[model samples]
Target chain A: MTILRFDDWTDPVRPVKRDVIAKLPEDAGENPPVLFVPGPGHGATAFAEHWLPHAAGRGFAAYALTPRDGGKLREHVHDVVQTAASLPRQVVLVGHGEGALVVAHALGRYPARAAVLAAPVLDRWATMGTALRVNPLGAIPAVFGGRLRWSRRQLLSAGAPVEAYGRSSRLVTSRKPVPKPVGDPPALVIGSPDDRVVPRKSLDRTAARLGGAPLLFPGMGHDLMLDAAWTDPIEAILDWLTKELSAAS
Target chain B: MQDTPDIADRHDAICVIGAGAGGLVAIKNLREHGFAVDCYERETSVGGAWNWRHDRSPMYASTHLISSRPLTEFPDFPMPDDWPDYPHHTQVLSYLERYAEHFGLGAHIWFGTEVVSAVPVGDGRWDVTTRSTGGGAERVQRYAGLVVANGHNWDPAKPEIPGEFRGQVIHAAAYQDTAQLRNRKVLVIGGGNTGCDIAVEAAQQAATVWHSTRRGYWYAPKYLFGRPSDQVNDRLLRLRLPLPVRQWLYRRTVGLTVGDLTRFGLPAPDHKPYETHPIVNSQLPFYLAHGRITAVPDVTRFDGAAVELADGRRVEPDLVITATGYRARFEFLAPEILDTDADGRPDLHLHAFARKHPTLAVVGLLQGDAGVFPLAHWQSVAIARWLRLRTTDPVRAAAVQQKESTRPVGGWSRTKVVHTRRHWFEVDHVNYLRSVEGLLREMETSK
Candidate 1:
């Protein structure tokens, strides 16, 4: 019942130097900015390659964050919340995979304009179960408290650059109940049925928790931000955010 | 409600008085819950007490946060990581400015507009009258609810000492810079955090500094074990350790680090640690040891430029600064509505929701061991949720109102503190935040 977090008080999550890539539209609009948080292994370049520029070109101020500290989930959440606070206006949070969990944690703190969860890893047990079957060697390291190495096939579908498969980082998971966000901002969940890392049921559960059905991007892999069909998901998010923000105003 | 020629009807809109830290967050939370809000501020900008430019702000030039950044900043809008553990008042103002801009709260605030009165017009609605600071025609706006967050630090509580002094005497609220203290015999009265801060400043600038206190206080160091002391103390608070154990730990630590105050010719604290508001100043003790400040007993009377202490010692000073805290003043509303006590403090349930009116509430009025901004944010969130519940289900809202009326008073203060006017709203930060969280859970589950 007492939500006074002592861990945060005693051992606070200090800010770290994060790699951020930002792109502003030539003619910036009144729409809220969108901050992109990449999943484990991937950095800001995951979104910077296509999603940030594409979204900015579509009249939205876009930013992608690579939490270089690689600390606990709260640190990543702190990075997202602190970065979002620094922006000129309230931002829409877009988190992918492990980053989606960080965004959910941040949602409990920051009142974002909107939220977008792409290829969300809602359940670690379910995701690791799928990973074990799809790529056994990559999933074995995760079980031993090491970084999970995602194969090129696991990250992207077709026509993606070799560098798109990001460097591995230690992934932390928790079973605590996600805090109900203030304002209960509108949420849009996106994933592909053919993704290797996250199963369809996991995406559906994430959508159910956020009060929506997943917007399926067929024939795509786990890395929606680096997939050959990354444009579709980015466009869908920009369109949904535009409508949500306009309606709220 | 009917729209008249003069008074505008803000249909379903909530009216918030003040755009300082409390009012700004109130507006943000209410808007987040889908409520249109209009906030009126007397000053031209925000940052209620922290805004030094505001005429009534109590902030001096050298003021820094007593609580560390982690304990002080809002949960959502944290202070920048690069800032020090204790940031200056100007940094606080800029942080507030960043919060306002990030949340787009500037659009809803009416700068330089002061609320004249807020009269409850049945059914939780209020008729709020306002006037421009630039001296314009008065305007009245009717709203569905009212949130009074005009802040508690602006009004100075100048205590009466029997006789008048011919010297330049000013409350800490009016003491701005070193110009008032330079090369003069300065007597800083009261033992609160502000008093210790002013005394330290006087030690730096004044020719001779005499610090006066009615009673000895437990002086908490700004740091303990290489970290901010509040952060270290929070470990015990988080573990839900008993009050006696926590106090013992604090006393032991202070004894080891600071030794004894009596050894420095100051009175030993009569009360236990945590009995009074924690004075987080390490500099005061340093100055006392260095002979920059002479500790004196309480002043009994003022004779011309001379002051007589309780210990039969007389000290004549060129200027006197009374750092005796402040009283919460709600000038726009009737006193009886908030159940004002003899000490001019409001007796609202949980120091927030009004018992008489379901929609009337106040924020940022309590004194806590930690930062006030996070507490204000939580209070605003609870108020916003309660207001939202009122519209969706009036029956449940009325039940909550009934429950609020019966809720016990002073549950968050941990234990019995010294019964002084200054301790009227003292709360243990952990306990108070937990209670507010409990209230929020009740409202959400009932809905």
Candidate 2:
């Protein structure tokens, strides 16, 4: 439906040679591939640490993207869309935090088999306000077009001390309204009520846009894929995809 | 066709002709809308015209995309990020192959099965009779709808000259490689992209090359300002700048890049840049500048091994390749069903929905300044939405039918196109897509 995207038509994203971290099952099943997109400051390592291997272990072809540093939302979305197209089959887009925003935009272009948004920063202003209240040092720099840094306590409740990669990156603050996904792909929103980066209302709003309620994971932090209990959410996602896609086909 | 008891009853399925890019997307989009589709491709493989192996393909050895990859690829299924700006025909074929594979559309496609006829069976259904390409018994299957995407490029439009020439004359459709032009005097006719491409190839391979055109055309460069020219043009279009402004900008860019083409003995362009199907060939100008290509006026007559020009001159050429373009032809469906215009082109609503029948639609029937793939994709998606409306709310569908007739197709073109068979389906990409978006919004709101 976004065929008349003039900006995209005129200023298309240039192709950059980047690596995609992948973990394939011993015997890949007919299940759709799961492509995980990390949010700002997070590399593919965020998912490659646990979620990717776990999803692949659960009989899916799992892949993660290491998006270019300091890319805008459009560029990130283009990268995710292009990577998904290169996959053997339709993929389940699993986006974390700001990557979820990219996934939300990508859904308008890509007809994903299913979508999973983990602690998605759907409302940038609301997330910004929350960050300002709790972590002024990280949020203030981000306000002036600088990188947003996150503390280990902010990203994960319990895990090995957060890597430097866990710090927040530059944020996109475009005022354009979110585009409704094409084909209305079944979507699942996963978030933690105790997350410090994203407010609870933003999660509810995102779920509402997708015509669903967020599957809340209490006591978990902002980085669901990198959190100590990463397996819990990955299992929930795979289980939902198995049911929804089977019913769709 | 025999009415055998084995005739399949697929009332729930839609029958799509030609498993090219258009047909493949039609099948995928309809299936996305929860409609069962049965797509038939006469060729053994997919990619339609992009597949050189297909007998109906008009592809030649030097056939690279005139438009860049971003606009050329499907919006949902993009070409590879690593692909060049303008991919070659083989890469295009592989892209289509990958598209089919990724979407799992191959299962729906019936390869080597050519639809012989599609007769509407009173109701909103069609009795689609198909036969195997390798001479087999014809089989008829009943379907709820029919989509014509056989493509218009395969049917070559040979030009008419007064006298017969002794030299071997062939349509560009048949010109496959330089082997045909090597060591021979070549006369490349027409001012289309294909004509320019062949002329450039002939300059490299032939002993002498004479490019004969009826009128001079603006040969746009493939790139401008270090970016694909079409993208730059689209930016202006996206800004909704007035037609005059965009046209002025276009002329300025062309002036700076491909300065006065008449310096190479080519005539001044008879019309504005947007007034014709854009011929993007930077090499044509390069060849013309090097004196490898001699531009001649229109052909007046053919005099046994020599072609007489409009001016008082004659040139003898061993081979004549006419790239005069193609006409839209649908052999399977009755011509009346398409509601052809005075020019015999299918006068569809939005160049998609057949005015006469709600269920009958056509995809990839038009030519735009940009790539046709995205246009074709949106057209199919609109068709699926309309078909769904026809099933759910017949009243709204009827209202839509009435609205479609009031509007004209390709009305968003920047300038009045020169009246020619080639420009019949010409449209400005950004404007046309905006109109399509308008129609989609209407469909959504009405629902």
Candidate 3:
């Protein structure tokens, strides 16, 4: 009956806790706890299937936080913030798609050890503003004001965003400039060239904002986590995580 | 004549030759029509000219159907939506395998059995003699109907290039893969799809590549504005217009002119109104634009390692590929029944029944730049119905045969059929389907 299921290293016997962070194998003795925040329309299940099994295989005890009630962006953000507040070790945050933007907003409040933003959905206004130039005039306003606004929060929760979400969200949002490091944690960003749904240009801008840790693949589609070549980027994230966790220790 | 088997001992029911696209369609159609059809395929697999891995096949990496997925697909089976807009050779082969499996066609398929001779018996039946490549004893079979779906491309025709070159020379059919041509200067002779594809692939690994075409060809894209161009062309050809006028309009719309090739960084040949490749897909020009491939004039002579072009240019190439077209050879049939005119295609009636032999139906022979599956499907249906009538009512069969025999045989001329647009062929396919459908409907209604 269950369409998707994956193995998680943290708390193998008990059901996953909503607030507690899980420690990766590499983070066992003195490693930093890395929290994997789920995107809009997704849950801890997706993170388990897409990220945890692979990440745990690479020796990282990654924690995927569950979604909260009402399932709004504000509530989920509060959930993530509440979960991060209790972690004893210095936390390294990892967000995918729109969850990257939420991490960006949340990082301004709760400083993490390091951030890994995979295919981030940045500013909606600047993103859609650019798309409206090529898009037909009649569909511009509604596409920008109504669809783009609602989809960004949805995409942040869901691992994948609609095509309109990529176009309009890109038009309205400007690139978020990388802030001065409060904790000197290195951020790694990865994307695919063949991603039609999420323009590689947006990933480039996102990488530039994070001081250029971009890893681009040619034939891979929009779903980077599902790609066969995901191991390279995921390994890079673990390597960065290991170095950071060591330095923190 | 110790123990030689007499040809008369062969059993006859239905003999379908060539396991390519057309042959499979004919077999499937006849079986569906409740006829005990036995298909004789020279090759080990079904997929006609579209099949790869056959030693005699000239199919290349870029070989694909020019027809859109919708039109190219069998009426009963639609292509998968997840498949690319223009399916590749592997995809096409997989689809054919699926089609064969769905229709239970393999049990009837006689792989490695080459039809050596097909002689007509006295009572509207055929005596078919087959030889297995395994050196086994010859097997002869008799059938009530005979369908020649052997297809057009059986013999590779190489251009007459004077003097023997010391370098390696191979026909497109013999080209297995591109492993040997790495870092070597390659000369790909012929401007058709195979030549272009070879030139492109060779350019990627080879030091350099020179593509030679005797004449300029109009390169038609598989898609126009994100849709298959054949879809638009098919609609246009169905409008009752003079053949020449229709061809002209088709050329203007879908066909890429010489200037268009220049824009894509390919050299336009000096010759006018060139021939296009029958199989449509090739990524050569795309690679050419990126400086991976170079175009040259036609070859006149080969002097040891160097080759001299008709345009007075000379270049040395380590390997030469002849992408020259193929000739359809039916050696098994009698010379009278296997009649060919000036253009070399067997003289047939509307490309279905042979003019000299009304009892014999030839599917997949008449190609006009369009996909042959639909045409072959319709032809099979018509042939099946005709056979059904022949069995049910001998009097009507005789009358129809008498009427058809009175009609004058048409002359074969390549020049006449060459100017025909792809869309014109689609119109023929549609018309053939409708005619066959109408005949089947009439037969059903009367019953």
TM-score of each model, in listed order: 0.97, 0.96, 0.57
How accurate locally is residue B2 in candidate 1, as Cα lDDT from 0 to 100?
25
Query: Tens-digit lDDT track for model 1 on B171-256?
Result: 99999899889999999999999999999999999999999998888999999999999999898887889988998998999999
Write the number of the candidate with greater TM-score, choosing between 2 and 3. 2
Candidates in order: C-alpha RMSD to true structure:
2.1, 1.9, 20.9
Q: Each candidate's lDDT (Cα)?
A: 0.87, 0.87, 0.62
| Model 1 stretches astray by more than 4 angstroms | A161-163, B1-6, B413-415, B445-447
In model 3, the runs with Cα more than 4 Å from the true position are: A1-249, B1-12, B238-259, B262-291, B341-344, B398-445
Q: What is the lDDT of residue B196 in candidate 2?
A: 94
lDDT of 2 by residue, B1-447 (tens): 475657688977999998899998899999988899999999999999999999989999879999998889998998987888999999999999998988899999999999989999878889998989997788989999999999999988988989989999999999999988989999999989999999999999999999998888888899998999898888787678887787788888888889998998899888876888999999999999999999999998999878999997999999999999988988787888998756677767777878778899999988999999999999999899888888988888788777766665546443488888888788888777877877776678432
Cα lDDT of model 3 by residue, B1-447, tens digit: 212376544343577898887888888777755677778887888887677777666666666655656566553343553456568888889878766764557888889889878887756677887888666677666777789987667588877789999999988887767786789999999876677677777988899888887665666655554456665555554564655676677566544421256655455534232233333433565676777777777799999889998789899998998988677778788766756654554656655776655568888766544466756776776787777777778787667667555544322113333442221222244444444454444443132
Per-candidate interface DockQ score:
0.81, 0.81, 0.01
Q: List the residue pairs that clash in candidate 1.
A: none
Residue A22, candidate 2: alpha-carbon lDDT: 97
> What class would a CAPRI assessor give candidate 2's docking?
high
Candidate 3 docks at the CAPRI level of incorrect
